[model samples]
Target: MPTITKSNIDYDKRNLSDKALLKLYYNMLKPRLIEEKMLILLRQGKISKWFSGIGQEAISVGVTMALKPSEYILPMHRNLGVFTTREIPLHRLFCQWQGKASGFTKGRDRSFHFGTQDYNIVGMISHLGPQLGVADGIALANLLKKNGQVTAVFTGEGGTSEGDFHEALNVASVWQLPVIFCIENNGYGLSTPTNEQYHCKHLADRGKGYGMDSFILDGNNIIETYSKVKKLAESIRKRPRPILIEFKTFRRRGHEEASGTKYVPQELMSEWEAKDPIENFRSYLFSKKILSAEIEDQYTSEIKAEIDAALDSAYAEENIIPNETIELNDVYKQFEYQDIKPNSNVKELRLIDAISEGLRQSMEKHKDLVIMGQDIAEYGGVFKITEGFVEQFGKGRVRNTPICESAIVEVGMGLSIAGMKSVVEMQFSDFVTSGFNPIVNYLAKSHYRWEQNADVVVRMPCGAGVAAGPFHSQTNEAWFTKTPGLKVVYPAFPYDAKGLLATAINDPNPVLFFEHKALYRSIRQDVPTDYFTLPFGQAALLTEGESVSIITYGAGVHWALEVLENNSDISADLIDLRTLQPLDKEAIINSVKKTGKAIILQEDSLFGGIASDISAMLMEECFEHLDAPVKRVASMETPIPFIGQLEDQYLAKGKFESALRDLLSY
Candidate 1:
């Protein structure tokens, strides 16, 4: 706990080769000079913006040196120095800052989020804390590969406040994933200082709540930072697990390219300014006689010249993506969203059977597809959706993951990032309530932030039937669709599940596939053997008669189908909206226009049902198309009851048929 001002290297225990020490000391300066070079660019107006990681170079450089190219490092935007150590070319780094495609990761990624696939660094996420989720996932993938790889995620003190940070730590601890959450506490989160943000004093203390080994390190001391992380990393390699390190340091510069650090206390800045990690490390090297004055000056001068030359070259390079790079390698093409082709000759299939079959075919079609969940392999899931899947596909293909819900989601997401198509099953759809973090933060927003796509499909069992009370059953599609980056689907029949699951797997986004456990075995129908596909936004007009159009999907689709069959003359078109985000609003409006009336239905409680969103949309787009006020049929606003009879009443108890009858009276 001593304040890390300066420390001498112990040559006795680890005889320092002057050459090795020179390299380490040299690396420390390269990243520093790069930061200073960035400031020159900022001043010259060559670079519109940049952030400088001046004080924290010791830890970032030390950690970068410890890497094995196969290990993943989630770096912060400010840590531009670490990118070079990971073998990211200096000119490319400069080009990225100057808005050129020649930059580290091409123009697709922000200059700050430069990633090198060659160094096994999965792309950097510019957003704050969520990279820890990706880090946990990367560790999970490395463990699965038995590749002795590690993922070190760098975040700031402000990141600990995000839900993703807590959720990631919890999962990494449970699964013992080889992830290290490095917190660079430089006092402020874009001007809101950490001291003013939280009651939890040290960021490291937050990890203990999730049962992780929390380490507080003096980020400015290379000797301490390197030695401590060396052992921690060794322990992780032995048997991967998550760790949190709080690097108590302060920023020498501002947050980002245009940050105004005027509010920073001058005294506080002066206190940390003297112990600048690079300068301290240089002094330590000189004290040990490891670097002669001539060599020290020579290396510093050479490094500064190299940085200046790289920046100059980067400034002169063209900013546009090269014609060759437009489709270069296309190894990234290995991972993509599969669009479900709309089928004109598609037949009906059972939801579970269709989904399971789709899983099998997807595994057959794509070598990278991995299916996992509690009881999914041998038992074919709780609903027997995956029954006999383990026998047909090997254990690795249809995996029986441990009972760690968040880990399952994160591991699957991690695999997806590593160019794999992963299908994760929820034992009961209710279990999805536990793993929402990775879904929303890492999976959902990945495409938007970095144009990074994850083809991870989650088969969520939803709705209430067969007496699955509160804990066993629930419809939470509303929770998913509320987020803009996710694709939510609730297939009423097996055929829709088959087609939509195929679409979901092919989709360039995170898809929440809701398959009602109640309807899994309750009904059976003729499913297609060949030529199968379903349009996401296209709604099915079941027994269309035209007094009212009822929009619903999933279990409610069954009820609407039944109502259509029972009262054919009453004439209500049942529109099964397979895709929620794309929503097929055009179809709904057309149905409402033809029928001149509308009703939306859902199995979730009426209070926060998706029907509300639809009702609001209809009022905005199609108020004139309505013959009567748009209506909604949803479960009553109560937690599902224990009694089967009560559950039926609590849920949508033939409510659609009655609503249809009332609408026909319109």
Candidate 2:
């Protein structure tokens, strides 16, 4: 990778035509005026909040003008200029700020928390760095499709401190993706100054460590910003590779309207104010004969008028109610991918083999499907579930990712956004905490935020019976179950595991597929040779009885079965909830109603776990039918110990049986 010195572009020798120059100015000016109006409205208490990108006009508009209209851009909060450049109507933007029904997210989100499929612009979440990796995914998809396009994702100087920034840049550089990491080095991360943030003089220098071509330029010079980005974009189109462009700039306003600038020194504010991007660019246009004083004045007035009209119209519109049903709409979509015809030829396979076969078949069916994880490629995963997959499907589809959980899921988000199905795996389900942001914020909310279908599946090897210790053995299904747009599937048996995983891959939203580590090799069952799908939110009646109804999933189903078979006098009904998110409410109610007793079981921690949710549902739905209090049997609340005997005691079968016996007797 070549390293170039940072410099300012000469306006006298600039290449952009006069017409294009005026449009660039307009793009920058529009956002500035809109932001000014937003501040005024905020003061009057019409709008609730605002993140002023007051001094960021050039960085936002310049880079936006540099890219092709077809390319994708994941914008930060300050990049309102990107939205304007991409033709997001001013009225809609105003409506969004006013929390009106016509806003980009239909008022579900505020402060640039919206994306438009039509514009190919992904809006930023409060957590900004992860979107960089999401952009890498789109770039990856473009490369795979042989499309001549590039992705430009924005960030700030302070955002560089995040682990996601490193992970995103590393992944993009490793893959040689066509992504531009455009950083606005505004000298401060909120209240903290740049000197305190890092020792490095420039943030772009970090790109060199990742083997990415990097550049730094004067952010206030719109011509320089546009010219450099245009050159980089052209190069990226020819050969896909990540590049970093750090703009030397400053934020003139406080972090937000409510955040006063008492922390900022007066000397620094005056210096930045003098070099205001909008004023500097306006003077440059007039001095260069690109525009007369009269024309500049006329354009500024017209822009303000346009903004005022938009604001007036926005205020006239009705405020959004954020109705529960509508806010929860489009959480999950019912999907049937190919017919699940039962095969006469049956084979006895372990739970792991069935899941592997299901993945293999799904890959064979969808050419655009990609499986990504740390050891999933050469090592075939820790348990050999994805073994031999690389030799069969090639490395492009079955990728070996760095040990960055967040980027892995964000890559899935990018691929899904670019119209491909992606399956990601965590080496251990317990490590999913690292990737929780992308999973919950990006993957889980993409559908609700922008109505964007993130057809991604995250495979997690979970549970504690295998004695993998605390880090390896954890049932974290409750985390995803509470998340709205995610589907949590934990199948106990081989047939259900294969069938449910198939359905998850087909589902048009993010699915957290939890495969019990203990059940993988221990459990063997007759699985159909051909493809099949078990519908989500439906529970299988493992055993029917009139005394107690045992509602459980994953390895807990096996425990319930063992109890029912051995303790014949108990006369309990066992229900296996294949999918936890779209829970089998009907099956649970009907069984509880029939037996008049309910026992919720899970391998997760007893308190605030999935069992608690099940117990709550049983109480709410089957309260009248219950003959006793809804009991729950789960692993001890403490972390799983290394000792085998202690672990057994932690999830003792006797504990579960005791709960069932109490429920039955009651």
Candidate 3:
């Protein structure tokens, strides 16, 4: 077992005043008492669950007290002292525990699963590692703004095993960001001991691997923790850099009240109990004549009364009840439609050129907009879309990120949290699977869970016509369209691509902008030279007809246009859906009602594709107007092959002709 070490630094030499020392004591004492009362409430069946931070109070209180109020913090569930020390309203915190509508997250989540921008605190999701990357983003924002703000993120020893932990640390060190990664080595991670977690002598030693400054201190010693963290924060503020500090501590209680500590040896618990941070500190204060029995009694009675009043206020509030309208309204910010039209100042450009021009205009328009991807700066990315951007925009705005997709995406979310626009390029849409967790779990749910807006645009270079194999070529729009709180935009033409991309960057929600690799250079159109934006959730009519309605997006739009061009006898109202999430269902219903026939096309495989949902919607909404059943034409349900012949056979283009003929004949 790892032994707890002590800090050799003398506390008498520290510059802290008596009042500051007393403040730290009160901060540490408050959480301990709050947690004890919460446990009693849990036993009485008042609160559903309580994660006790009884013995680990000093680490949370000390670190939080050291940071400035403007600096951001991402705290874990066990960091109640962080909240209490930050001075989050006690009544609201109690309401959050009791599931009241007035609490943070409006009672959407229990425990410390929500963040409050007012307090400069970004709470962690159950996935503890992603927050590290988020901290990097916040620090990066501060660095760019020259604010000298430091961000502190906490995690358990078990979190070190995660890929995000490594990715976040490496990125922070490489960027020399102002972030402090505090690892609370509490001896056990949900009953698994440190021996089973890793073979490292101390978790802080791993910081050397990332070229970061690291320290190991006695977490039970509150004064040492506060002094070290305060100094570290000051140093980082002066010369920004990442630091890792491992506080050797023990979890005297179980992970949660529900999980018992039976796995822990009795002797180990007894040993840690003897070194209780609060009691030890109180005794030391008494020895120094700084605290007396009467003063201690007064502090205890005042804190108890404060807790009792907060509890009474929380119980007085009404519990949260499910409301369909309110819940659905919280999913995404309301999008207003703008019919941005082209003018005389226009130039013929390929889809790629249109996108680049649009991005350039957006960068110029929004000074805070940042573009990040692998080799995007000097190398100009694999597609060369951001070529020559470094000279015009500089390396800060046009950044080359490490090949860490997951952390980069979280960083984008963090940038958004810091009130900046960010565009993250996934070199290939297929690689989005690596960064799926943060996009789906955090960014997509930020607005719904809390009032925080994730104004991030993820540029996905996708499609299968280039024969780049299964890994590089894929149409994955269906993956995000199915997820709520996200806007999925798949533009086909150059004009639509430029306009939609500009609009997505300005949108106040997470938008997955899918740009088909095949259409990037193949199609050209006269787009507006100046900035423009097209409305989302609105379908553009490429061809007007009355015989049938052909609905598609991305590469499918080109294939449907080809069918209409070849077969003049088959008159069809071709609908190109620019945005899939906020689908133009009304346009679809109206078109199908006029033509009495419908067909949905997609580049993705037929199974679980966006076509399936459109087909189902047509059936449900326009059941009486249909001449025949709605048909769906999509690529074969198989991984896209690399070879030319096999790829053509697997694509939806080959199947569209037959499906269109069947719909016409019917």
Write model 3 residue lDDT over 73-166, tens digit each, in one string.
9999899999999999899899988889878888788899999999999999998899999999999999999998999999999998999999
Off by over 4 Å in 3: 1-13, 335-342
Q: Estimate each model's TM-score.
A: 0.77, 0.96, 0.97
* lDDT score of residue 560 within candidate 1: 78
Which of the predicted structures, 2 or 3, would earn the higher TM-score when compared with the native? 3
Which portions of model 2 miss their true places by more than 4 Å?
1-12, 333-339
Q: In candidate 1, what are the lDDT values of residues 1-666, reduced to their tens digit?
A: 112334433322265466766777788888887777668867988777777788888778877776666677878876765777776778777776666767654564565664555666655455565567767766766766778877888888887787667767877886688888888998888899877878887889988898889989888877667667877888889878888999989887777757777879899898888878777776676666676778877887998888878877986886685566443332122334345454455455666677777777777777667788887877777778778878877776777765656657766767766667788888877877677666776676555444466678888877788786888778888888888667788777777777777777776567788877888877676676553456566766665765788888877887877666776576667788877865888888878889888888888888777899888888888888777888888998888887878987887856777776676677
Which of the numbered candidates is closest to the native, going by highest lDDT? 3
Instruction: State how far residue 382 of model 2 sits from its true place (Å).
Output: 1.4
Error of 2 at 112 (Å): 0.7
Whichever of 2 and 3 has more lDDT, that candidate is 3
* The best candidate in terms of TM-score: 3
| Candidate lDDT (C-alpha), each | 0.74, 0.85, 0.90
Ranking by lDDT: 3, 2, 1
Q: How close is candidate 1 to the true structure, as a TM-score?
A: 0.77
Better of 1 and 3 by lDDT: 3
Output candidate 2 Cα RMSD. Answer: 4.0
